[model samples]
Target: MGIIDFFVNLLKDPRGFIAGWIVALGPIWVYTPLFLIVFVETGLVFFPFLPGDSLLFAAGVFSADGGGLNLWATLIVFYLAAVLGNTSNYWIARLFGSRIIDSGKVKALTPERMAKLDHFFERYGGLTIVITRFMPFFRTFAPFIAGTGHMNFAKFTFFNVIGGVTWVSLFVLVGYFFGGVPFVQEHFEVIVLGIVAVSVAPAFIGVIKAAMNGRKGKGGE
Candidate 1:
């Protein structure tokens, strides 16, 4: 009924929430969930609210046991998914980024916020692709901003590969390694929450840093 409730339902049963993607393209599609997950999480503008980090964490946990999904296959699927997903998100920005810039929906994005993200991408550059990959919610927007700014496509792609591979590898290996513990199995919710916190902490830190910087700059100006 409510936004939180709807998201809670999704968090409870991803397969149910992700049924459209699963049903439309089965395993024959090779990392179907990975593709759609990455696509919605990154590629689609309307889907900023989707579970990017948590889903990856869950996928990692699921893949740990080798549950009919080979580790290599999972990695390959997710890696490609993440890479393609960002590329797609970037182009989507290229296509419609200008249109949204002045819209009410984007009003939440103050110039200071834009400047912060700009400063981040500037300072980190392509490596933002790599570093933010490990970060949770931030990963979804990195490529989008890169594209919106018309950063070199070739450069973005290079880091996309690095980030995608690194991101998928860490989580899948994590799932593969610690997924089988009885305690983790019993307390999956706690684990998922922890993952969410870990993933979100970076964005939280970034926002706080940005806010502090904004205040200091204003005071100085």
Candidate 2:
């Protein structure tokens, strides 16, 4: 598996993964790895489940130390990654999204799912792209969808910048500010799990609501 895949899988046992990494990479890996992780996470839809929030948080925590990289530096690297990643995904959608969708290679984005996502992007437009940056599968698909729908580039960039900067700053700052606390250090995995769970909540709610409506329609029929 690739490096991102390794990190993503390690999230399944986050506590161990985080500890191992702080020791293994020391502080130098922080610079390039930060850029690469965010880039791939946003750029490649297949790697959506990779850890963005937690990774940033971890980087922030590292930056707080004397040997670690600078917090602002980390933010800059990842922010660029986020924007460029979506930009790449946007082009990918422009060129091949429909062809792939039409070919039925991707079963998750069925006609119904595609319609639902379109409705979501229309309702929220570029904000949908930015906000879903924190989300898992949705984050990966949002830019791709925007490409397919032919969302205006200027608008996409606006929200994309806001979302990328804000999302990176929020998590990184939080990790920098509070990462050293005994509770956080000890329960890091729990926190990561909580974040992941909350991140997926909207999608979960959507699925539940859809299921309920389906049941109601069947009953009425």
Off by over 4 Å in 2: 1-8, 13-29, 107-112
Q: Write the per-residue lDDT of candidate 2 for residues 114-156, one digit (tens) a residue.
A: 6667877878776787777777777777888888764877888
- 55-108 per-residue lDDT for model 1 (tens digits): 665666655443444566667777777888888878977777777666747443
Model 1 steric clash pairs: 60-175, 64-175, 64-176
In model 2, what lDDT does residue 109 have?
58
Worst 10 residues of 2 by lDDT: 13-22
Q: Please provide TM-scores, in order, for all candidate models, with all chains considered together.
A: 0.81, 0.87
